[model samples]
Target: MITLWLFILIGAVIAFFWFGRQIAEAAQQHAVGQAEKLNVQLLSVACVKRRLAVLSNGRLGIKSQFAFEFSSDQQSAYTGTMHLENLRLKKMDIPPHRMG
Candidate 1:
């Protein structure tokens, strides 16, 4: 009886490890699929922004302000100010930036 109990204990440990590995692999595959979809959608959007900066509002997980320069044609320049809602961008202000 003691030997049988020992064998069952070892089996339980092996099963736990196998189940954990399978769950982690499934989560990683889901993340990869979502990233691929985002890449395709971003390619369709023609706007390009650069020289970005993020400002925090002194609260946890809250971005108070953001500033960047973007040009749709990649030739002209403009500065943008974005407002955040629930950690996502809600509004954007992009006026023309004077070039030298």
Candidate 2:
């Protein structure tokens, strides 16, 4: 029984990281698309935060928030956020940045 429980725990840990990686990839794609649409350069996209919350659209999901750095003029750096819901982009909150 102890060995069986250990296997279950290990499986859960693996699944957790697997899902997290998938979510991070989706968030990165969303962030890149958003930055391109805004005519900014995506410097970096990192999965820096995560939470379980009900979205404003009234959907209960795992919210994976990625913090991204962007540059419009290739000089000034700016920060933005991309929110993902189970590997789907739920919302994007990017403040106005410089435009080149």
Candidate 3:
């Protein structure tokens, strides 16, 4: 029925946003952890880029990148980035900064 298809379409839209939110949350957590591991204080985290791509294992998944700000001495802020394939961390690029 048309009503059934309409419901399905709405459900798919909701699911897509929900999935994106899940990935963003995972990226934030991972970014925070990485900053802590480097002994820096995480100031902010935000999702910067996202797209569907084939991962290293050839599995199609959402590729996400998060940009974050951190401070080594709470005085100077530095920028960093984290990349994820779905929920798996692919790479992290941290700018050189003095270690506190």
Candidate 4:
């Protein structure tokens, strides 16, 4: 029973790590796409929030929020936020920024 419990814990950890990577990749892609669409330069992206949340389908799912920095001109930077659910982009917030 102890060994079985250990296996289960390890499996859970593995799943969390695997899904985290996928979420990060999806977040980066979304950030990049948004930046390109806005004709800005993407600087950096980082995971901001992660939790189990109710999705649009009314089911519990892994939700991740990413914060990204972008620059329209080389001298100034702006912040953007993106939310992803189960490796899919759910929403994004980009503030008004100056254009080069």
Best by lDDT: 4
Which stretches of model 4 miss by more than 4 angstroms?
Answer: none
What are the per-residue Cα lDDT tens digits for candidate 2 across 1-100?
A: 9999999999988987888888888888888788878988889998878876786678875678789999989889999887787888867788777668
**TM-scores of all candidate predictions against the true structure:** 0.38, 0.85, 0.88, 0.95
**lDDT string, candidate 4, 9-63, tens digits:** 9999899889899889888888888988999999999999899789988998898
Of 2 and 4, which scores higher on lDDT?
4
List residue ranges in candidate 3 displaced over 4 A: none
Prediction 3 TM-score vs. true: 0.88
Candidate lDDT (C-alpha), each? 0.43, 0.82, 0.90, 0.91
Ranking by lDDT: 4, 3, 2, 1
lDDT of 1 by residue, 1-100 (tens): 9999999999977965665444344433433343353332111112232222343544433223344444444465455455543234546554644433
Q: Each model's number of backbone clashes?
A: 0, 0, 0, 0
Extract clashing residue pairs from model 1.
none
RMSD of each: 14.5, 2.3, 1.5, 0.9
Query: Which stretches in model 2 have alpha-carbon errors above 4 Å?
Result: 51-61
Which runs of model 1 end up more than 4 angstroms from their true locations?
A: 40-100
Lowest summed lDDT window (length 10), candidate 3: 27-36
